[model samples]
Target: MTPAARVSAAIALLDDILQGAPAEKALTVWARNNRYAGSGDRAAIRDQVYSALRRLRSAAWAGGAGDAPTGRALMLGLLRQEGEDVDAIFTDARFAPVPLNDAERQMPGTAPEPVALDCPEWLEADLRASLGEDFVPVMTTLRDRAPITLRVNLRKSDPAHAAALLAEEGIATTPNPRAETALSVTDGARRVANSAVYRDGLVELQDAGSQALAQAVPVADDARVLDYCAGGGGKTLALAARVSAQFIAHDAIPARLRDLPDRARRAGVEVRVSDAPAQAGFDVVVADVPCSGSGAWRRQPQAKWDLTPDRLAELTALQSEILDDAARCTAPGGVLAYMTCALLDAENAAQIRAFATRHPNWTVTETRTSRPDADGDGFFLALLRAPAQTA
Candidate 1:
């Protein structure tokens, strides 16, 4: 497909997304319907769709739609913002976006702070409360694609060795400062899945912040660890790389962990997958619970628009419940790791504080909160110890 045709496809997909269709579903439908579109065309269209979604408000406003906008208007605004020639992509020719009229050709005026930063007005206050002075800057950063990062499985190979293996496959990487095992994909990021390093379990795709959080876990040698909510078992696997421990991964929905065994086998790690907590007295218990995912908007922009106050409250409640249960499962004097991929205070420190209030004997040993940046996604990890026994 031509570049102009890709933009047109993106406009249609965006319209579907705006009308309540999930971005993934809309893209899949578009792909199945347009069998003639090659892999390159599909990838380009997907990029355009996601890029526009990331900066929906700013793009819409710039396209002269002010507060009200359509998908076509949003794309026009996105091009305008990027300093691209609007006429080139919107030729009004076959399979191309309609040309901008005089009204759309006119440059947009200034928008409100939230709109200017591409943040929803309703979430502005909450985001500001969480991010403080970095709100605007952070939001601006989230309006772009996040860099791909991978965690070197030290059990198999070191970072340097892993980089060499990846380079052999035409995939380039650089050491990430966020974590000792973290590597940022510098080139051929799309080839990571097919790279020998990744296929051979030398490295696993993960956010640098997540790698840092995993490193922050104070897992002792031979300690038994329980991942309370091990969705896809990413953190569980990270912890496994650091310690020779007995690992058990459990989730509320067992289906979520269906592939964990295969993943563990590929990574050459032992992780017992369970639908429920089989036994208690774990040395370390990690509750990486449900969250609003405000910190990961750059990678999953649709989530930003789908989140609601009620859903956030539900997630916080669930997180608190999981923390409570996970704390109970920790062995006496064991460590409990409470974590989330959310920037909201209510989900991070606030939940920890509430846990402290409920169990004054449990004491916080360490707390780490990483803000979203060029190196990593935002994340929070709090390590607490169960009360020691007294004779």
Candidate 2:
């Protein structure tokens, strides 16, 4: 497909997304229908659609739309923002979009501050309050694509060795300073899943900050660890790499962990999948609770726009409940690690503070917060310890 045709395809997908279809679903349906579109064409069109969603408000403003912006307006707005010659892409030729109208050609003036920042209007105040001075920079970073990062399975191979193996398979990586086992994929990101290193269980696709969170948890040799809210067992797998621990993976929706067994087998680790919560006490219990996922919006841009105030409140409440439940599975003097990918204070430090307030016996032993950067997405981890029994 020509570049112009890709833009047109992206515009149609964006229209379907704007009409209430999910971005992924819309793109999948489009690809299934257009069998002629090659892998490269589909990837390019997907990128265009995601980029537009990431800057929806700014694109709408740039395209001179009022309340509801059409697909053409969004594409035009994005093109204008990039300072590209709109005529080249929107020619009246077949399979290409029509030329921009007079109104669209009359370049829009400066957009509202929030629109310019590509932040949701409702979330501006809370984001500013949570981030303070760094809100703009962090939000700006989220407007672009997130980097591909992998965590080396230290039990099987180190970062240097993993990099060497990946390089042999036409994939390039650089050691990331954010975490001991992290490797930032510098090239051939698309081939990572097929790389011999990844297929050989030497490396796994995980955020560096997440790897750091798993790394920070105190685990002794032969310690029993329970991943309380394990989804897809990524963190459980990361923990397995750090220590020779008895790992138990449990999620509220057991179906989420259905593939964990295969993943564990591939990585050459033992992870017991549990339908119910851990009945016995564990040395370490990790509750990577669900939240708004505000920090990792670069990868899931639709979530940012889909989140509502009520939904956020619900998530916070759920996080609190999960923390309390996870605490039950931790032995006295054991570590209860609460984590989230949200940057909101309501979900991170504040939740831990509230947990401490409710359960006086528990005390926060360690806390780590990371902002989204080239190394990883924004993440917060607070390790709380259960009180030791008194004689």
Candidate 3:
């Protein structure tokens, strides 16, 4: 497809998305209907759609007011955001989008300081509370795509061997200091799934911060560990590699763990999946519960825009409830690990503070917070232990 044609496709897809269709759903439907579109064309169109979504506020401001947001206007706004002139592509021709009119051409491009930053208006206060004076820079950074990373399955192979094997397959990766098992995919990310190392499950895709969180859990050989909210079992797989513990995974929604058995098999690890906790007592209960995903807005920009204050309040309540239940499964002298992918103070430090307040008998052993500045997604982990019986 011509460059102009790709722009036209992006506009149409965005229109479908604005009409209540999800971005992925709209893109998939468009791909299925347009069999003539090649892989490159589809990839280019998808990139443009996501790029516009990531900077929606800024793009909207640059495009000026219209009856509603059109694909053409969004593309124009996105080009302006990249400091590119829209005239080169939006030429008046058949099979190409119509050229920008006088109104669009003369539209003032200056963005209000806040909107230019591409953050929701209501979230400004919450962001400030979470990130302090660095909120602006942090939010700006979230506009970029996150790096693809892999966690070397130490149970099967070491990072060096995995890196060498990936390199042989043209997928480049560099060691990450944040997590010993982490390899930041610097290039050739598209080939990961087909790479011999990845296909053999010597390495699994995971963020460095997430790998760090799994590492933080103090696992002992033959220790009984329960993953209380193991959605998709990413952490469960990571934990299995770190220790020879008897790992049992459970989630409120059992469907989430359906693929876990297959994934565990691929990784060559044993993870028992169950809707309820196992009969045996647990030495450690890791509660990696749901959150607003504030720390990962770059990877899923739509989530940041979709979040509302009311929804955030509800999530905090649910998180506290999950923490309490996870604590119950912890045996005497065991540890309760609380985790979330939220950078919001209300969800991280505040929740930990409240947990400590309500459960005075529980002592916080260690609390760690990872920001987006480094090589991975933002995350928080808190290790709390129940008090031992006094003489």
TM-score of each: 0.97, 0.97, 0.95
The C-alpha lDDT values of all candidates are 0.89, 0.89, 0.86
Instruction: Rate residue 343 of model 3 by lDDT.
Output: 83
Query: Which residue pairs of candidate 2 clash?
Result: none
The segments of candidate 2 whose C-alpha lies over 4 angstroms from its true place after superposition are 278-280
Misplaced by over 4 Å in model 1 are: none
lDDT of 2 by residue, 111-210 (tens): 8778887898888998999999989899888888888999999878988888898998889899898899999999999999887888888899998888
Against the hidden true structure, what lDDT does model 2 obtain? 0.89
lDDT of 1 at 133: 88
For model 3, residues 178-213, the per-residue Cα lDDT tens digits are: 899999999999899888888788999999999999
lDDT for position 208 in model 1: 94
Residue 171 lDDT in model 2?
Answer: 90
Model 3, runs deviating above 4 Å: 65-70, 107-109, 278-280, 389-391
